[model samples]
Target: VLDRIYDFERILTRIETGTVSPKDLVALRESLAVIPQLKQVLSGASADLLHSLNDRLQTHDDVYDLLCRGIKDEPGLVIRNGGVIRDGFSPELDEIRSIAANSHAFLQELEEKEREKTGIKMKIGYTKVFGYYFEISHANTKPIPDYYVRKQTLVNAERYITPELKEFEVKVLTSQERMLALEYKLFGDIRRQIQGHIPAMQETARAIARIDCLYSLACAAYDNRYVRPSLNTKATISIKDGRHPIIEKYLKDELFVPNDVTLNHEDHEILVITGPNMAGKSTYMRQVAVLVLMAQAGSFIPAKEGSICPVDRIFTRIGASDDILTGQSTFMMEMKEVSYILKHATSRSLLILDEIGRGTSTFDGMSIARAVIEYCLKHIHALTLFATHYHELIAMADDSPKIKNYTVAVKERGKNIKFLRRIIPGGADRSYGLHVARLAGLPESLLKRADVILEDLEKNGGAPVPAKAPVNPAPSPMGDSLFSSPVIDKLLSVDVSSMTPIEAISFLYNLQKDAKEGSGIQ
Candidate 1:
């Protein structure tokens, strides 16, 4: 519907001024053609807005049919150059074109008509002396028509002319000019006819634009397997197996792990997410904002299931960028945005704050981050997703039921680590900056020196990293520890002691093959 919308505005304006070109006229024809399709697309839609728009849509079938036959498919740009109008549209235009294109045929018909009228079998000829004349042999005894005025006399033949012949000569000579003039008139008449329906067309175009937006949203929903979230006035945002709409598009089906979020007005009001860098902290916060926005905007969200509450406003402080023109540093912009959030944000709002205090010294940044959290808990009390590198923020979860701690799970393989990209209930104290540096192509010697320095700092009580994860911590990946499949589950449940030796062996072999097949290990 919105494919060629770029040309519609100018086309309508030109139609009003009576100067629309044939190329632009084709655009109008295409717009008129979409009316039926629009009606069909919105045929059974239950939305009152869509139904009203459908009602407002006028089917200008006559205008469409006229334009289809009036203009050439591929016409010249300028109307005066001719070839703009198709043949057989206007009888007068077609006749003028015939005269210009078939002058010789007309002359033959003229000679035949004179022969029939006078019975002389006169032949037509032309010369430099006289333009066109009829010749008759003197040997013939038949008398020439008295209406033929003698033009030339010869020994054995005589040439004469008629008023009709002279009239045809003038017409054949000036046919090109007359044809161009008639084509221009026919094009203008068609343009005028279409001009009267400009208001209807403009309304139809607006309808198409509206449909285009909704249709695009629908396409996104269908392509990404997005579900329509149940919207309510309640104070909870619960989603099961939720996904980031953008991140999932480019990632492999199994590679992108889905996480669940449950935020409400009371127990789980503020979620404190702690994770290492490049672990999707910001992505999770943004996903919530985007999903909420989509639900409120009447579009589907990328989640297996969703039930969302409408937020009055969604405030975000996610990325790090400076306003160089305003001479504002990253920290200054961060404070300003947070100030605005605190001032305007209400309890029904959603606040997505990421790394609120990393712009200054440790004490100052931590102090500001803590103060913001306290303000959220006491005064503002918004449904917030606050992400931070300050691990001390996790201690707030113990004191307040409104706060909850979440971390990104990972798998440590000797010196290498893989981000599980799953958010679980806990906190992570170690940022693994050295590991990330090694992954980023840092020199091995520098990594070794940094590790040594980190060890010294930990020993000296500067940055306290635990020797292991806390007791009964969230599940972290281990090395191939009983990878589960249907075959494995069956093997665990089956009573092998009752089976005979050969039967047991056969069952084991079949189970191995099934496991391999299930794992896609062809």
Candidate 2:
């Protein structure tokens, strides 16, 4: 019924032209027909909103009844055809239809009887120029009756028409013509009668549309176990155990870990989120934005409990996207969006920024990112969720009470790291980009070389390490790194089982000699 209801405004607009088509009128009737069912559906609801919507709706059975009685059950797209109006609705129309139906039936009977008697297999046919006649093929030499008056001749057959058949043909053709004209007139009357109820029906359409939206929202809330988030006009947002509405839905065979978020006009205005790649930092930030928007728009949120206030607008600078149409690089687009946000955002606005100033050189990117964060904290003061890999900026949180440091927790297990996907207090100190690459299936040889380079960077500023330490150091829990030095690395790489006794003696002599001299150990 809802699908059948066409645009009510279209009906109203068309009536100004003085007539509505049968298709439009049928659509209008369906629009009215569903109103009673809608009211009944809402009748048992306790919500005053649903009750108010139900009150706006009425049965409109008068319109439905008029249409049911006047129009054909399967009234086609046109009114000019004869079947558009129901039979027996009009006495004159029924009389005309009866004449046409009975005439056609009689002609069929006459054709069959003559075929049996004459055994010529004759068939009744009609033409515009030749009215009605019986056709017999040249192959049939059997005789026809005396009443079969000659009419016309074909190249291979005889054509004849009985006086009785000729009389009924006139009645059939004329009644059919009158029947179509009458149906067109009757369909017009129905369309005009509906025009009088256009205002009421359009109002009801609005009510039905509202009810449909609310009902769908209710169903989603019930099915997804969504909680109702409280909404207010203040500039505070606090959500406990908040899950990403979208990401949680697609997590197969694994559960989504929900995180808590808190933001206010003052102290907790901006969050500097730092975490390793794929640690759910982006997911966490986006959920805070999504939940706030949902709550403000009167929707239940995907959280245990939340209290959100309406923001003037929500601005985002998320992920890597280039505007190829305008020849803008990803960094250029990032800057443009950030510029706009900084220019317009008020304290009440919400901003979800992921990796701002990430597309340039490391120092430049870090500087720009820091400047942007500072501007947002001191100037815009908007509620912000800023996710970045730049651990250097975590210090900003220490300086200002408005900015707070948060990280998605990570756990190191032996040589591998596991992303816990939990956001907690304190900033992440390392990115673990190599670990993420390992998970993404980088070559082991390349990863080993990269790990060596990273170790060098952290240890000796990427310079070549000497053979060994100048002095002995304490043993470590981290798998004997002192013995795994460059000299020891070569030692471990050798196949000791394959070495001859003489070769093993030679290798031991070289190591002892290298250990005595500072550079010989290499």
On lDDT, the candidate that comes out on top is 1
lDDT of 1 by residue, 242-356 (tens): 8898888788655667889989978889999998888888888898899999989989999899999999999998788899999999999999999999999999999999999
lDDT of each: 0.86, 0.83
Per-residue lDDT of candidate 2, residues 1-522 (tens digit): 355456766676786466666666677677777676767778999999989998988667878898878876577776666578887789988888888778778788878887777777888998999988888778986667788898988899889988877877877878878888888888777777877887786777787778777767777789888999887677889999998878888999789999999998778988999989999998898889888878877789888999898999999899788999999999998999899989999988999989988899877899999999989888888999999989989999889999999998999987699899899999998899999999999999989988877887779643665453557775443333435476677688889999999999998887666554533323
Best by TM-score: 2
lDDT of 2: 0.83
Candidate 1 regions off by >4 Å? 1-24, 30-34, 37-54, 77-82, 107-192, 206-224, 322-344, 357-368, 374-380, 398-400, 456-522
Lowest lDDT sum, 10 consecutive residues, model 2, at 475-484
Q: Which ten residues in a row have the lowest lDDT in candidate 1?
A: 474-483
**Could you give me the TM-score of model 1 versus the true structure?**
0.68
